[model samples]
Target chain A: MSAPDRFAPLPVTDTPQERGDAARNRALLLDAARRLIAERGAGAVSTDDIAAAAGVGKGTLFRRFGSRAGLMVVLLDENEKAHQQAFMFGPPPLGPGAPPLERLIAYGRARLAFVHDHHALLSDAGRDPQTRFTGPSALHHTHVRVLLQSAGTTGDLDAQTTALSALLDADYVEHRLAEGATLDELGDAWETVAVKLCGR
Target chain B: MSAPDRFAPLPVTDTPQERGDAARNRALLLDAARRLIAERGAGAVSTDDIAAAAGVGKGTLFRRFGSRAGLMVVLLDENEKAHQQAFMFGPPPLGPGAPPLERLIAYGRARLAFVHDHHALLSDAGRDPQTRFTGPSALHHTHVRVLLQSAGTTGDLDAQTTALSALLDADYVEHRLAEGATLDELGDAWETVAVKLCGR
Candidate 1:
């Protein structure tokens, strides 16, 4: 399937009012799920708990997302879209205004932070290799590839992006943390390599 | 435990006469295990099959390696040591006596090849986060760190190694390939990052 089809955020329409309601509903459900997940954890939080917390019917929860896993994916996709917007349009150096190398460096920090914040849901996605490799990852690869090109990298851009993206895998980050690596070290390491790739 | 203690290879004594028999037995069993795994895959090949193929008793297999998992550990350790020695003392490029940047690039290529050759066994290891993170990976990170330092990398050397090693993770490599990445692309990408880190 196409990248957007696989990972695009809840489709926005031309109309603002209907989109607002849909957006609000999504936020409500996600906020409730996030609260329950934080209180207990991903494994313990259930569909019933989230729906009840959101003051929405169980049927609406199921209709909005087919299952618990589906809900988690939608939540993660929301984060992914926000990240895309941050890098694509938000502000420098993470957005379009900065130099290529600096933008790439900022992008790494932003992506790593996103992975850290959404650790529970994203790590759950890591358990399945297909889900881990698809959708949002495609967008990430494209983003990195564009940055590499804009930065005047001479090597195979595809490979560079793949290596960079691999570092952002939540499973790898979690594994590194459990292995005693600090978040500071993780971001620092990314900057070292990313700057190098940007020919700085 | 220290990194060396956690990920170190099986030690062989300096006295050939004393170590020869033990080493021979270990090699003999491993040879049989490799053949059996190649023929029927790691999961299908039983301990009994390895023992029978090696012309040793089942009791001996159990005595040498405590369990199936232990046997797998020993097998991986053998490969890990070869990798360590290659980058530490073998010859130019992959070994000592080459430019730091060359050695680092060679090391990345060698590590990728090792992961590919031992794909099944290592992929199995990826299922357990502790085993996956603490064992051979510690050695890999150390190896990469030393290379980065020797090549004059100034940023977060620790994080740089972590990111580089994550790209070589068997599960991640497999996922990338399943998502349509070629080994050539993967290696080329490593060279890009390694060379850049080396300030080439």
Candidate 2:
């Protein structure tokens, strides 16, 4: 199934009516933040460092993202959108062209990789229980549900989706990694689950 | 298989050498707290109410459990022990003597019930990521791993156990419940996962 409008990228919260210069500044700051975060880790990258890296003043950085925490959230959202694009529309396996079960396995591995790479930024985002089930999470749930249905798995799809998604949760993934499981091992384990659920 | 020493109840941290009367007071306070929490939700119950119900002064309640948060932790620990005893030592299905896969299914149902009944308290206790993988969580992992190994399941046991446990997490269960899934539906879905993993 093709990616539907409901699966659109997470809405960027910046004002829609911003001028061209403001939009450019926003993109520059986000790019700089992402680069700095990748280079020095999210915790080590300061707002000042991001502003200096973007060649913008500190005031512009704060105005763009509100606070350090806000910037981290936006960064996560941006990354989440890229990930959504990959599995929903990019190519075979993780995208639409592969078999349902294959796509499901690829999705788990890709999602795990995303979480592994963005662990610091994600952990720092603070999982607010109230907001955990909305937005990007809801989209992920829908995507998985569709795949599960497509795979011809019988039983309660909603419950299965929740169970599967729980395993892919960022915090749960981090907990497993901390407990000494490699990302590849986690991905393999998830594939086992996906295969089992598809009753192959 | 019998419950091992390692799966014993969570260690109660109260001073072991307390006077007989102090022990009595401690039990009284805990009983009162449990009764009050059952009658009124955990958030609605208070240390003062617990003290009054136990026919003790607030000072004794404080000295017994340290503080409100301390009392909640001890309460959760006590409940966790009872749950551990049931699955580890109690009879059949959830305990011993049942087929490994049946036991696994029963374990998931029992665990979902535990989290369902203690939803407010568990959520109130807060999920600290650092301590999440230790203590009771670790014990749960070992129990599930042992069950999988005994059932002759193939693939990564640790990873599989972690994935399974993630679905049974209190927060994830609560999230599903809030999203309109019934406890029975959750149990059924879990049974499906267990059956598939056991290759039944």
TM-score of each: 0.65, 0.71
- The best candidate in terms of TM-score: 2
Candidate 2 residue lDDT tens string, A7-119:
97755676678878989998999999888887888879888899999999999987876667667777788679888999999999899899999999999899988888888
Error of 1 at B148 (Å): 1.6
Worst 10 residues of 1 chain A by lDDT: A10-19
lDDT of 2 by residue, B1-200 (tens): 47696787665565677888889998999899899998989879878899999999999988876667667767888789989999999999989999888888899999999988887777655444544565466788899889988998887776667657766777779878888888898888887777777677
Instruction: List the candidate 1 regions with Cα displacement exceeding 4 Å.
Output: A1-36, A43-72, A171-189, B1-75, B171-186
- The digit string of per-residue lDDT tens for model 1 on A1-200 reads 78768776665422355566566766788899988988997767888999899988887777666566667876778668877888989989998889888888888888888887787787665554445555576678788889888989877676677667767877777777877987777877787777777776
TM-score for chain A in each prediction = 0.69, 0.70
- Candidate 2 local distance difference test against the native: 0.80
Residue B192 of model 2, lDDT score: 77
What TM-score does candidate 2 reach? 0.71
Per prediction, fnat is 0.74, 0.55
Which 10-residue window of candidate 2 chain A scores lowest in summed lDDT? A126-135
DockQ per candidate:
0.40, 0.39
Model 1: clashing residue pairs?
A189-B159, A189-B160
